[model samples]
Target: MKKFILDLIVKENEHINEDYFVLKLTSNDKLPHMLPGQFVEIKVENSPTTFLRRPISVNFYDKELNELWLLIQIVGNGTRKLSEVQVGDTLNLILPLGNTFSIPGDKNSRLLLVGGGVGFAPMLFLGAYLNDLGYRCDFLLGGRSEANMVQLNEFKRYGEVYTTTEDGSMGEKGYVTQHSLLQKKQFDMIYTCGPTPMMQAVASYAHKRNIACEVSLENMMACGFGTCLCCVTDTVDGNLCVCTEGPVFNITKLKWQI
Candidate 1:
């Protein structure tokens, strides 16, 4: 658990009347290399109710610039206060703190990445890596509306991008699972993150087709590590900490009730 005082070098509200924000942080100290599915625990400088540092995924990183980017959505007081931070502000952070997705092998591997809402953060980095390795990838993103689909443009370079919106305000009108690729294509592997129902849906789809699938789960985390025992889940392998054991897990091992 390496700690650092990172200066909020830039902050941008990516949407209107929405909670999504892109935060860029810089530190004089050399930070650890962050993996795609890993996250960071950030301490909101002066809030009491938001006492514990919030764990947020590492959206992207720039080694040359020595910076880290986080795609945050304000869903509560902690994140709401986090959004209020301005440039030059500083926050305590412990980053690169969780397990990551496994890169797929084979040139013809049909890789499918599915995300919803702010859960798209990890996929951006995952997509970039797959693209760098000469792998073929397809991204399916779903949101309530176009405004909820953040960074869809940024991911175009990494793969063939597809979108779905409940209101038909974007690429296609329906849930991402309803996208043609999910319904028609046979992927060698599928990686997903989002709401539980959505993840469960993707997992079920992959399971039916016998495709290898992994999901990065988003749960309410306290310690952002294994010690807290806050983010626990029952799996085929028994109970595991979502914070440390996962954030990433094989879909086949997930003991889903639904």
Candidate 2:
């Protein structure tokens, strides 16, 4: 897919909570084709301490609205600066970066989308698209607490949303891997993104059941494009750049011990 350095208008910047915020941007020009797992590198402004641009997943895209959503957590100086951005502000973004989620094309496809922490950002868009495709999709989100399990309502609108809170204060008392949703149903595919351990666990479960699985890697990225070489992950195919080659990779390609 072609790339663009678009200075998009910040249509809305709403803080979901003290820890998370969602930014909606609109492009004055035409946007390139953006897929569910792809991300964008936004040049951060007003933060003297941060020099590098931040890479965030494309949360959702509305073609008719010409709008793109980025679900972000205030994890560092760059993100904190972004949280302060207001409507009408222009954000320079190198976008439609990385590869996309592999949609199960079959109408009867039964899928499970798993996400941990801020990893949930990309899954909503993927699930929504899958729903549009008439596929049976379920979402499994895991966070440290109910507070971290931020947008269940939005997720529920797309498909069945199951959650796990580490503190036992939410949907399920254990991690996402322990959620009953997995045991209650058989899935054609499992797509996940999260902490290393969590993803590995999900992959192991998928492997044990011989289910096709793909994971969106959340490696630290500097450049949105592959030129940076900072987000390389060891794969069966060799060291691959997660930024460009993927933010998404099939579990068969990964060399995890699981």
After superposition on all C-alphas, the RMSD of every candidate to the true structure, in Å, is: 2.1, 1.0
Model 1 over residues 1-258: C-alpha lDDT tens digits? 453345444534343346788888777766678778988888886667887889898888777787888899888888888888877777778777889898865878999999998889998988887887799899999999988888877889799898999999998898888887766777899999888898898888888888898999878778887888988888898889998889999987789853
lDDT of each: 0.83, 0.89
Residue lDDT tens for model 2, 1-258: 888888999999989899999999997776677889999999999899989999998888887788899999998999999999989999999988899878766888788999898888899889877877778789999999987887688899899888999999998899999999887899999999888899999999999999999999978877869887989999998999999889899999998998
Judge candidate 1 against the unseen true structure and give its global Cα lDDT, from 0 to 1: 0.83
Off by over 4 Å in 2: none
Clashing pairs in 1: none
The TM-scores of all predictions, comma-separated, are 0.93, 0.97
Measured by TM-score, the strongest candidate is 2
lDDT for model 2: 0.89
Cα RMSD (Å) between model 1 and the true structure? 2.1
